[model samples]
Target: MTKPIQGFSKLTKEEKIDWIVSNYTHDAESAKIILKRYWNDDEALQNLHDEFIENTITNYYLPLGIAPNFLINGKLYAIPMAIEESSVVAAAGKAAKFWLDRGGFKTTILGTEKIGQVHFMFSGDADKLKSFINSVETKLRSEASDITKNMEKRGGGISKIELRDKTADLDNYYQLHCTFETLDAMGANFINSCLERFAKTFKQEALHFSEFDETEKNIEIVMSILSNYVPNCLVRAEVSCPIDELADNDTDANEFAKKMIQAIEIAKAEPHRAVTHNKGIMNGIDAVILATGNDFRAVEAGAHAYAAKDGKYTSLTDASIENGIFKFWIEIPLAVGTVGGLTSLHPLVKLALEILQKPSAQELMQIVAVAGLAQNFAAVRSLVTTGIQEGHMKMHLLNILNQLGANETEKATLTEHFKKNSATHSAVVEAFENLRKGI
Candidate 1:
């Protein structure tokens, strides 16, 4: 067995790769070749990628695609989406185009309050702890001033601090819950900096407070960090039109609206359907989040938690047809930033923001929410009418063809052929095989 090697990180890049492959990989030479093959040709770009995280090896690339005709708040946009999925961009584009002539999407920023917490354990007089907490709110803000000065100047700073008692959930558990307005930044770093300062001040002040005994003053700080769950940092995107105008060349307008509402209702009432339903919405949201170098994982976590906010996991979207008007909307928590992190650093991210017309953080939130709503609308419209597989499989045809190793001419021919016949893996494979056999 290969034993653990010391100073593995200190080894030369080539030596480290050789050791790792020699010890673990089945084909060491091929593994090395694959790793080196993905490295950027430009030294500067390679260095930039390496600095994004620790122990970097080679850059991993995802395709960057543009979905055009996104009409949001009366402005036209071509959204950049970076994703590996075959049909996400196509689905989003279809939705955007469908809504473009139908009055487009309208968005509203419900709130912009981010949250953080300083968790601690205190086994002392509950009343005394409560009293101390009330007195420290001002001190917490005052002490965190250094950290918040710049943010305050930009009209973003500490909103409030509250002492939350949670001893019923666990023994001696409590939290200093804090809220802030981060303006044009997602402000994870800024919020975290302020939280750490508050934690330090809360602990140190307890050290010399005359009202506390030796054991009582010994408040043990568990952790101080920003929360990904920012329900108050929400955005709403909705599209509305007269029910009569909802018709297509083939589908009836009123029936289509009712079918769409019924589909949403099913998702709201069933967990099994809601998970997949919400995932389809995230398919579009995550693509834009990733394209702009924001945290999609955080957005995913917050959104799913919000979906379950009613004590049961449900759909993030809603649909209704009433009084000759049909409406579809979604209110989602998305704490994205127009500045900071990779937004200012990554070349592609900068370009993506430029393509977005350099929107403010609030504008970006609106756009992301609109993207999610559009994606869900398209998915549900397909699900209720033509069936989802029709368009999805069509979009997935190129992927299947590539997987079957079709060359230029075959791919071109198959691409045209699939438009006439249904595209499926087995069918494509059989056709390719028959073509190979001169059939």
Candidate 2:
């Protein structure tokens, strides 16, 4: 059994590594080597990575790829994607190239209102609490002024503060639901700061208000935090072309459209399919979010919540054929910031945003939405035509080769062999064994 160590974080990096490996693992030296092997050569760069989070370990790596020829609005963009998945970037790029001449993608920002909340409880009169909140609204704003001033100057700040009674949900539950307009930033810190200040002001004002009796004055504030469910903070991306232009691989356009629509409809109605379907969309969304240094966790939460906003989880995408034109689109609540957070700090994040032509928050939202739509299109197109595994497995071939411990010469031979044959794990393994036996 391993004993706990105190102040582990205070130790030097090597000492920390030694403590962990010696205490936890049998092969301490090898484990230590693995951790240190990933460190950057440049000391300054390594220091930058160390400060990103606590408990400095070696930097973890993911491939940063580009999906080129993404024409949105009128200009072209080469979207940077950071992901470990094999086929996502390839599929997105393929979809982008497919739609390159067909007017590319068109996007519209439906709204940009982020949200946060202050949860509290009061065992006193509900009517009195409501009236007290109504009268104290100005005070809430005034108290949070210092936090919101800079944001307001930037044309982004608190949009509204409402008193919501939820006595039925839990004992004396209430909320100060606040809405915000954070123009060019993700606004998590901005929103939360305002909420905390508002919370402090809320309790202070309640205690001093003349109308508030003893019980009402003791308003207990549970917590103040930003919400990730920004249904109103939405963007839409779509692609449309003549129905006759939808043909592929000598397949009829109408039939192809019909099959794609069915696939989407099935996803829209079934949870099992919808989960994977939406995951495919996130494969694109998360990659861009990672590359641009936005919070993928918050985006994922908001998006999934929005998908089920209508009472049941469904597809985030839609497809249709109308007026001899085939159309596909996706509307997602994407709360991303082009400034602040990791966007300016991380070197790769800055490069990724620059490569994207330095879009505003709204433009970034549109670009992300387009990438998701394009990815889903590629997935559906493959699903309804050639099947998903055909392309996915091909992209996954290298991973399998690496896993099987194949040398460069053997991997090359196997790669060529799999191009003409199936790439299933068992099949590849069997083929490798047979090839070794001169078969």
Candidate 3:
């Protein structure tokens, strides 16, 4: 572990995140060390290092602020987020505050299941190969059964198998998608391991097909990959608030609702806008994923794909106002977990989970879904009222001041000047030395 920096405890939350970023190396191992201290988990410290090397994927950190004053299902939560965008945190805070003024958010979960794919390729007869594989369906299930035997005792296991045809390849290839009920655990790793173990059976079955002699016909097994297309296991939440609570300084309740709806429509109409719109929701989702050391990338890819599932890119959140009440709904493919792997080991993740009081996997997903809904509320409010850039530019000025190395007094002066003169980086830098000298 790196030496603990002095004065860390005295810094504000934003400053602490910035300090960690400035001093810590941006790597999985380094993240594990820092998180371990935060969560007090030594095992997570070891596993993070292992997973980083095994996955061969790089880590990117972002500062996503957690808003306070959240009351969901009559429970208060200090939500964590991992995103780089500006308005998300402030917007969520405002939206939550508005809801709190009314009755706060009420949420629920559906269920959780992830898809695993197993592919088989044949050079000779596709029919024979498909038949051969189908004949051993029971045996195949048995092979996959061992992996989930424990899960079965817990009332979760492989639920079904699906087949698809592809004629574009030179050789006939078949794709088998296996769906499993993962309960509270994100079962990607388990599903992949199960399919890999069953590959030998699939290969053995292919060799026995009558159309292709084992010696002559080339039968190869392609990919045994885990998919994020979680159509089965989905969680949803709906929040309602009195329109009077959403009223702003100049806008009436009805006017605010109409403007929010219009802004959301704009986001739904354009792909570029939709990307940012969905990203706002993920800001809330990814933070929890990171805190638990779950696969954030898989969750991200699944969410965006689910967003575009209807062939038109759009926002993940929907809102409507009726009978003097405003309602918001959000549905995302959130394949996260509370137990196993990094969740049990990573320190900061553990700390985050503890701060959250170790919610069940379903409970955790519910929190994330609510966070997404709150974040969307924030974004739409900004777009409808003062314009998104207004709040964003104000916060960005701090980053600009840091880049210019202005002292505390200089920073305050520069912030005021930039607020008045439309602060540009070059303009700030030009006056930076003079302002520092005066300080």
Candidate 4:
């Protein structure tokens, strides 16, 4: 049995790798080679990556691809996507090209308010607690002035604070729900700093409040943190064109519109379908979020929470036919930043944002929303007509070929063959064997 080692993090990078591989890997030398293979050639760049997180390890890489011809708000953008999944970038490009002449995508920023909260246990009377919070709101804001100063100069800071009583749910449970406007940034660290300060000030002041009894004065703060459920930080992206314009060589426009609407409706009503449907939307959103060096996990959390905001998980997108026009749109809460975190640090992230023209936070939000909508359009379009596997499997063919040990020449030939045939795993294996045997 393997035993845990002490001070593992204190070891040098090489020592750490040696310990890990010697203890766990069957072939330690091969494992060491694999780990070291991904390190950057530039020493400075490799050092920068090593400092990104604790217990440094070799960098893991993903393909950074561009989905071109995304026209949003009268401007054309070639969205950079960092993802390993096959067909994602291609599908996005296909959707963008399809909508290029049809008034591409239009987006609107509905709101940009973010949330933070201080959870506490109050054994005092509810009415008194409410009055105390109301009177102490200004003090809470003032105490965080240092943290919010720079943000305020940029026209964003604390928006509001509210006292929420939840004694019924859990005994003596309550929350100091706060809101903020963080312009041009994701605002997680900012919001969290403000919240921690608020928690400190609120607790310190409670001990001296004249209206509070001994029990009320001892307000116990549970935690102070930013919430990843910014329903108010929302953006909408939509595409609309004449119904007949949606027609392609293989599908009728009216029938296509009907089927698309039906597919969306089914997703809206069924959680199973909605989960997969929303995943496709995130496939686009996450790729852009990752490329731009924002927090995709937080954006994902906020989006999924918003989808189930009405008490049922449903589709993040909707479609309809009105006035002889087919419209498809998505309204999602995306809290992303173009100026912080990895945005300025990572080389690829910098390139990705530059490719996007250094958009503001709101502009980034719109672009991400458009990417998601376009991706959904492509996925649903495939689902309702040619079926998803046809395109998905074709894109997945090369992955299978690589796994089956096919060389470049065989890959090229097999790729051509699969273009005219289904690329199922078993079928590819049979064909690969035949190709090697000169069949």
Candidate 5:
């Protein structure tokens, strides 16, 4: 086993990549090979290579910042999140501080079972078809069981099969939900593979269809698809802070809590607001998802779909203040993994998993739940006070300066001038020249 990289944040961009490559089973040459294999465009590949040299692989690195002072489930952790958004890390840190000041974040994960869907299109009677599916449940389970034998040996396998009715269209469509215990893996591939195998067996043994193909029958099988209505496997986190911890003289801490709740309610009421609201939650969760090389797109799709499950858009996080304490909670569909796929192939992702010290998939989900809740806290706190643009623009100025390539001294002068006045690119250039002449 390779020893993990230490003090990653202390290293420069180049040093960080070097540390990741050196510690993992990959080197610069190997990284290049992997990059070329994925990216076919010569110019795009060159750009990546050039950016790698500049230590600007921001996509792979941004969420790596450590969230300190977090004590979840009575265990201390220094969590590293990779995200592009501003204020996420700061917000999580502040929330962690508030919780630690009281006790800490108390969280629980209810097993890891992701739902896979196999859509069946049958012309037969709905009642008879339903009976047929139920009759073959055991056979389907056995088929699923055989596919996940490895996971079964590791204490994870198919747990249940559920059927849902769909009569919105002229054609009758039945959805088969295969629930599987994923153990410490996200199990998208596993679930989909098992569902396909079960579908094959269902047609061969039960449906009596000599020729059944997932594509030909218009039978769509999807894995790890977002179901906000996911059965079980919910991760719940609660953080209680003394009312004084949320103190802001402008608003009573308890009143502040009410306002936070009200703001979330507003997001819950309107689709427009809920989009931004859920985006805030993803701003935190997606970072960790990406860091661990999980499928963020699938996670995002599922979370948003879940938010709208009740036919009304709403915030996924709920906040309350009671008896001189403020509490925050969120339960979102976070299907993430610690091992397999990119976690095994990507060097940086492997390094991130190492930094996380190889947490179980369930434990990882709870941590992500905390992050989503923390992100909501941050967004709400900002919306309630100081407006989002104030801090966002302050951080965005660095990018504007970098685009202009201002040196350290130039950057400081430019930043100062920009703060003093609504500085433009012309103004920045003028400041750059003035500072260069030592005028």
Candidate 6:
């Protein structure tokens, strides 16, 4: 067993790597070589990466690919995606091209409200607590004015704050539920700062309230934090065309539309299926989110929660064919920002935003939603027609070839061979060996 070391974080980068490999790795030299291999050649750039987090190691890289031909709201965009998955970018591109001539994706911003709370415990008269809150509401806003001034100047600030009595759920538990308009920023820090200020002001005011007794005056503030679940921050994206335009070389127009609707219905009905179904949608959303330096984890949490908002887990998308028109759409909660966090620091993130044409937060929400919808559309079209594995495994062929250590000639030959046959692992291995043997 490896022993824990003190002041490990205080060690120099080289010393930290030396210690880690000496204790934990079987081949210390190989481990050290691999770690340093990923370091940025530019010393200043490597230093910038090291400062992004604590106990820094060599940077991890993901391929940044472009999925062009996204026509959202009558504007063309070549979306950038950073993901490790093989077929995601290709699928998104294919979806975009399919809709490019069909009026493309249309998006709407339904709302942009975010939430935070100051949870506290109060064991006093409920009416008195309400009166105390009502009295100090203005004080709470005024105290946090310094923090909200810049946001207010940008047409976004504290929207509303309300006191809620939750004694029925937990003993003497209460909350100062607050909502905000953060505009182009995700505003986690802003919301949290405002919440802490509110908690401090509320606690101070409680001590001076004439009607409050000792227990009520000593209100124990549990925590002040922003919620990742922003159900009100929502956008909707949809694509539609005449049923005849939905046809392809292999799939009938009317049958394809009906099958697409049926697949969505199945996902809406079954949790097991819905999980995978929504995961396909996230494949696109998360790719763009990561590329653009947004919080994919936060977006993922809020999106799944919204899917289950109606008491059950279901599909995030819907489809229908009515009066000869095929339509599909997705309305999802995505709280993303364009001006903060990695958007300003990471070089690739800056490039990604520039590729997106420097969209505002609401516009970014719409684009993200459309990415998800387009991805799902591509996946479902495959599932109902040629089957998903056909395209997915075809894209995955390169991975398999690389893993098998195929030479350039062998890889090229096998790739062409698989185009005329199946790219199964065993089949590729056999073909690769035979090719190497000149058979």
Error of 3 at 405 (Å): 1.4
Candidate of highest TM-score:
4
Q: Write the per-residue lDDT of candidate 2 for residues 346-419, one digit (tens) a residue.
A: 99999999999898999999999999999999999999888898889889988987887878988899989888
All candidates in order of TM-score, best leading: 4, 6, 2, 1, 3, 5
The number of clashing residue pairs in model 2 is: 0
Cα lDDT tens digits, model 6, 234-347, are 999999999999877877898898899999999999999999999999999999999999999999999999999999999999998888899899999999999989889999
Q: How well does model 6 score by local distance difference test?
A: 0.94
* Best of the candidates, lDDT: 4
- List the lowest-lDDT window of 10 residues for candidate 3: 52-61
Kindly report the root-mean-square deviation of model 6 from the true structure over all alpha carbons.
1.0
Encode model 3's per-residue lDDT on 1-439: one tens digit a residue.
6777887656654465556665665774566456445432355554465454432222345564567778888988887665565556776777778778677888767767778888866555556656665776777778777787998898888887766666585456767778787777877778888778667666765556565566424556798988877755677877777777766687787888887777677777888988988887887677667766778888888888888888988888887778878787888878888888777776667777777778888888888888888877777777777777667667677787777666798788777776766444566666676676664
- TM-score of candidate 4 to 2 decimals: 0.99
Residue-level lDDT of model 1, residues 124-183, one tens digit each, is 988888889877888888888888999999999999888888999999999999999999
Q: What TM-score against the true fold does each predicted structure earn?
A: 0.97, 0.98, 0.79, 0.99, 0.76, 0.98
**Candidate 5, backbone clash total:** 6
- What lDDT would candidate 3 get against the real structure? 0.73
Q: At residue 12, give the lDDT of candidate 1.
A: 71
Lowest-scoring 10 consecutive residues by lDDT in candidate 4?
335-344
Please say which candidate is ahead in lDDT: 2 or 3. Answer: 2
> Residue 376: error of model 5 in Å?
1.8
Q: Of 1 and 5, which scores higher on TM-score?
A: 1
Put down candidate 5 lDDT per residue, 140-197, tens digits, no spaces: 7776666778998998888878877765764666677767778777787787788777
Question: Candidate 3 vs candidate 6: which has greater TM-score?
Answer: 6
The true-versus-predicted C-alpha distance at residue 330 of model 4, in Å, is: 0.3
Candidate 2 Cα errors over 4 Å, as ranges: none
